[model samples]
Target: MDLDMAQVRAFVHAAQEMHFGRAAGDLGVTQQALSKRIGRLESLLGTKLFERLGHGVGLTEEGRRFLESARRALAASDDAVATIAGKDRPLRVDVWGHLYAPTRTLLQVAGRADELRLELGHGRDLPGAMTALLRGDIDVALGRIHPPLSPGLAHRLVRLEPVDAVLSTDHPLASEPTLRPEQLRDSVLWAPGALERLDFLRRFADRFGVRERSGSVNLGLAHFLTEVAVDPRRFSLVPADMPLPDIPGLRSVPLVDPTPLYAWSLLWRTGSTHPGLSTLAAACAGEAGRSRWLEYDPTRDWLPDLPTDRAEAHSG
Candidate 1:
C-alpha cells in the first residue's frame, strides 16, 4: 500500500488521542485541514479509518493494525534525517515539566549545549505536557502518570516518593514523625489541583469522606509552598522529597495511613529518533538517577532493597 509520511504520522497521533480536534490541536493544524488529510490517506488505503462517536472518535480495526506500522515508518524517516544530519552535531529536542523531578533530570541531561540544543517548556499540569508532546511541540515530557500512559507514548518510571502534610512546626500534629489520614481530619487540608486526580490522594480522601471539602490551591509548586508557609494554620501535602524552606518553625510530617507516593516518569513520543533521548531512556530504566537523591531512608521507600550504580553518585 502507498503511504505518505505526513498522513501516517497524523493518523497515528489521531488514534493515540482518539479525538480529531485534540489530535489536530496537538499537530498545530486546524480540524478541517486535519480531516481532509485523514480523508486523503483513507482514500489511498481504501478503508474507513475512524468511527466518529458523536463528541469524539474511535479507530476501526484496520486503523488499529495500521497504527504501529505508521509509527515505525515515522521513526525510520526520523532516523534517515538524523543520519543525513550526523549524530555528532547537537540535536534539537523539546521537554516539558509540571512540578515533577523527572522533568528536572530531563532538562539537566538534555539541555547540555555540547550534546543537545534543548528547548525547555513548563506546563501547569500533565494534560498540558502530554498535549505538547503529541503536538510535536515538545519531544520529551517530565510529568506524572496517574492513569498510566496511552499506547503511542513511552514512559520510564524514575522515582516513587512519599507525600508529606505541610504545617507549622508548632502545630499539634507537627511533633509526630508521621500522621495517618484519619488523624488529619481536624487539620485544614490544601489540595493542589494538579494532584487532585492522583490515585493515592483520591483513595485517601475518599476513605476519610474529605474529598469534596478539600480546597483547590495553586498548581505551581513554589506558589503552593508560599501559600502554605504564609498561613500557619493551613497545610498543603506534597512529595516528601521535594525541598522546602524552614520558615522559622514550619514542619512537614509524613502521611502514614495513605502513604501517598508520587510516581514520576520520563515520557517521550514513541517514534523519537533522537539518540540522546534513547540514551536518557536507557539510563533512567537502569535507575541511574535514583542515587542522586537524599540517601534512601527506609522510612520513605518501603520496597525491597535494590542495588544502584555508585557511578551515578558523581554523575549528577
Candidate 2:
C-alpha cells in the first residue's frame, strides 16, 4: 500500500512533538487538519499510533515500534528524491553564536560559500540548534560542542581561537595588556544568552567568583558592542579572532592568566546522508587545515589553578 507523504510528515511531526497543537503549528496546519491527517494515517496502518494522555499525547506500543520503521522509510524516500532531483535544492544550515563572520569567511575561502542556505538560529547557543538537527529541522549546525555529546550526533572540529575579554574603553581594565581571570572578581561579565549554560563557564564562575550577566536572546555583535559601550561595568568574552564592530568605545583584550580557547565545530546527525552536508564538512575541514591560527593543542594546560573553596567563598 502506498502511503501519503503529507500524512507521514504529519505523523512524524506529531510523534516528535508529542503535542498536537505544537506539531500542527510546526507543520503550519490547523489542529483540526492535523488530527484528520493523523486519523487517516492510523486508519491506513490499522493501528492506534498515539493515545491521548490528559493534556498531552504519547505513542502507543505499536507506534513505538513503528517509529523506527517510519523514520527509515522517510529517510529512504528523501534520499531517493534527492538522487533523482540531480541537485540538492537548499541545504538548511543553523549557525550558533557570533561566529557567523568567521564561518562565512571560511566557507567563502573554501569555495563552498554557495552551499549555505543559512537559517541562523540561537546565536552562541548550541542546545537549541542541536535539538533542531535531531528533529530534522536543519541539515547542519555550526557551534561549540560541550563534552558528552549525544550519541546520535556527529561533529567535526572546524576551528579553535583564543578567547578575549571585551571591555568598554572607559573601564579601568580596558588598557591592561591582558587581564587575568582573578582580576575579574566582583566584576559583572556579560555573557551571550546561552553561554552560562556551558559547564566550563559554570565551574569557572564558581571558581573565580565572577558574576555573569547574559543579554537578550540571539544578541548580535553590533548590539553587544552597544551594550558594552553604554555600561562601563559590563564586559564580555568572545573569540579573539571574531570580527568586532568598529564601535569606538569597545575594545577586546586578551585573557592571559588562564587562556581560554573557543572551539567551533560542524555538527550533523550521525547517519545523515545529505550530499550537501558531506561537501560542507569537507570544505570546513579544508579551511581549518589551511588556517594557521585555528589549530588547538589539546595537551596544553590552559586554565589557571583554582583557589581554595574558602578563598572563593570569601571572594565577592
Candidate 3:
C-alpha cells in the first residue's frame, strides 16, 4: 500500500509537536487514531520516525533527515493545490529577536513593494530561538554566542556589542567614566537563573572577582538595574551601546579592565534551501547597513574587518 498525504501530514505534525495527543489535536483526531496512522506510515516507510522517551517523543536521527524531505514535499503539495485552486499566497519566513536590529532595517529598506513578506518572532535568547529554528518552526535566528555552534548550522556576525558594568546613578562608580575589573571584585550581582549561563558566570567571576551573587531569571535588565539604582550596592553587565533605561536611577559605566565583548550572529541550517535565508543575509550585509560588528576603516581589508562567524568557534 502507498503512503497517502494524510499519513505524511500526521507524521510531520507529530515530529513538530513531539506529542501524540497534541499532534492529534492539531489534526482534529483522537490520539489513538493518530498513533495508528503514524504507525502505518512508518511501516510503509520501514523506519521509525519517533522514539518514546518517557512522557515525550523525540525524532530519531533518520527522522531528522526525513523531516526536511517531508517539509519540502508538503510545501510542493500546497503550492500545487493553491495553483490548481487559483489562489495566490505569500511565502512565509520567521525571524526571532532584538539581537539583530540590522535585519529589520534591511527588510524595511527592501520596501513594501517587494513580493516577499517576513514574519518575525521573538524569544528569550539565542538558544531557545535556535531550537525552534531546528524544528522547522522558524526559518532564521539572530542570537549571541560565546563560541562554538552545531555542526550543520551556519552563522554570520551581525555585531560585536561591548559589555559594561551598569549600576545605579548615585553609585560612586557611576560617576567614573570607566571602571577597573578590581572595582567589581567585592561587588554583588543579580544573575540570570539559567544553568546554561552558570559556566559563563563562573569564568567571569573568577576573572573579575564577583563576591556575591543572586540567581533570579524573574528579574529582567530593567529590574536588575532598578535594584542597583534603589540600593546603590548592586550591578549587572549590560551591552555598552544599549540605551540605558529611561529610569532616573540607572547608568551604565564601561568596564575598562577585562572588557567583555559578545558577538551577535544570524543562524540558519546549512542544507536549507529556504529563500528567506539568503534574503535575510543580503539585507543584514547590505551596502548601507552592513553588520554593526564590522570595523569600517578605509585602509583595512573589509573582509577581515568583520568579526568571524565560523560555526565551530560559535558552538556552545
Candidate 4:
C-alpha cells in the first residue's frame, strides 16, 4: 500500500514528543487533526503504534522498531525533493553582524547568484545564528565563533580578521596608530549583549581591565554611533573588515598588543549532502586559498581554553 508522507511525519513527531498536543503544535496542526492522522497511520500499518496514557503517549514495541525506518524514509524523501528542486528553493544563509558584503561577494563569485535562491539572515549574533543552523532553520551561517566548536556541526575558517577598537574621534586613544588593550582601562567599552556573551570577549575584557557596557539587541547602528559620539569614554570592538557606519564622530583604530582576531567560519550540518551546500563550501575553500585577507589553516584551534570562572561568566 502507498503510505502518505504527511501521515508518517505526524507519526514521527507524535512519537518524538509523546504528547499529541505538543506534536500537533509543532506540526502546525490541530490536536484533533493530528489524532486522525495518527489513527490513519496506525490503520495503514494494521497495528497500534502508541499507547494512549492518562497524561501523555508512549510508543508500542512496533512503534519503537518502526521509528528508525520512518526517520530514514523521511530523510530519503527530503533528499529526493532537495535533489529535484534544490535549485528552485532558497538556500537560507545566516550572516552574523556586518560580514554580509564579503559573504555576498563570495556567493556571487561562486556563480551561485543565479543558480540558488539566497535567503540571508542578518543581525543575528553568533550564538543565535548557530542555534538557527542547528535547528535547520537555515542552511548555512557565516560568523565569528570562539570554538570548542559545537559537536554535530561542520565549519570552515573563512578568515581571521583583526578586531578593531571603534571610538569617538575625540577619544585620547583615537589618534594612536594602534591600541594596546591596557590603554583602554579607563574607557567603558560598549558591545551588543550578544557579542559580550562570547568567551573571547569575556577574556579580553578581563585581561584589559576595561569596563564593558552592553547595549540591548534592538540598538541600531545609528544609535550605537550616537552613543559613542556623545561619550568619548565609551568604545567598542568590531571586525577590522567591517565597514563602519559613516557616523561623523566615530573612528576605527586597529588593536595591537596581543592583537585579538575575530575568526569567521562557514558552518552547516556536519553530514549534509546537499549539492548546494557542497558548492558553497568549495567556493569558500577556493576563495580562502586565493584571498590575502583569509587565513586558511583548519588545523589551528583558535578558541583558548577558558578558566572555570570565565567560562561561567560568558555562559550567559
Best by TM-score: 2
C-alpha lDDT of all candidate models, in order = 0.62, 0.68, 0.62, 0.68
Higher-TM-score candidate among 1 and 2?
2
What is the overall TM-score of model 2 with all chains considered together? 0.76
Tens-digit per-residue lDDT, 1-316, candidate 4: 8879888888888887799999899889999999999899999999999999999999999999888677657655665776777745767887875522446445544563345456777745667776565444677888656655544567766655557788998998888988877799888867655554655566667767876546545366667667777778888776676666779888888877556655566777655556667667666656555554454232331234322222112110
Q: How accurate is candidate 3 locally (lDDT)?
A: 0.62
Which tens-of-lDDT digit does each residue in 222-272 have in candidate 3?
Answer: 665666677576777666766656777887787664456544567765555
Candidate 3 residue pairs in clash (backbone atoms < 3 Å): 147-314, 148-313, 148-314, 148-315, 148-316, 149-314, 149-315
Candidate 1 residue runs with Cα over 4 Å from true position:
13-35, 51-69, 85-97, 100-117, 123-137, 177-182, 185-188, 194-196, 203-213, 217-219, 229-234, 245-250, 254-261, 269-271, 281-316
lDDT of 1 at 153: 73
TM-score, candidate 4, is 0.69
lDDT (tens digit, per residue) of candidate 1 on 1-316? 6678778777878887899998899779998988888999999999998999988899999988887677667766766776668555443334433444445555555444344454566665567666566555556766555454455677665555566788776577778878776676666666565345544456555665553335455466666566666565566666676676545566778876446555556677777766767766655544434444423444434322222321222311
Positional deviation of residue 304's Cα in model 2 after best superposition, in angstroms: 13
Residue 105 in model 1: lDDT: 55
lDDT value for model 1: 0.62
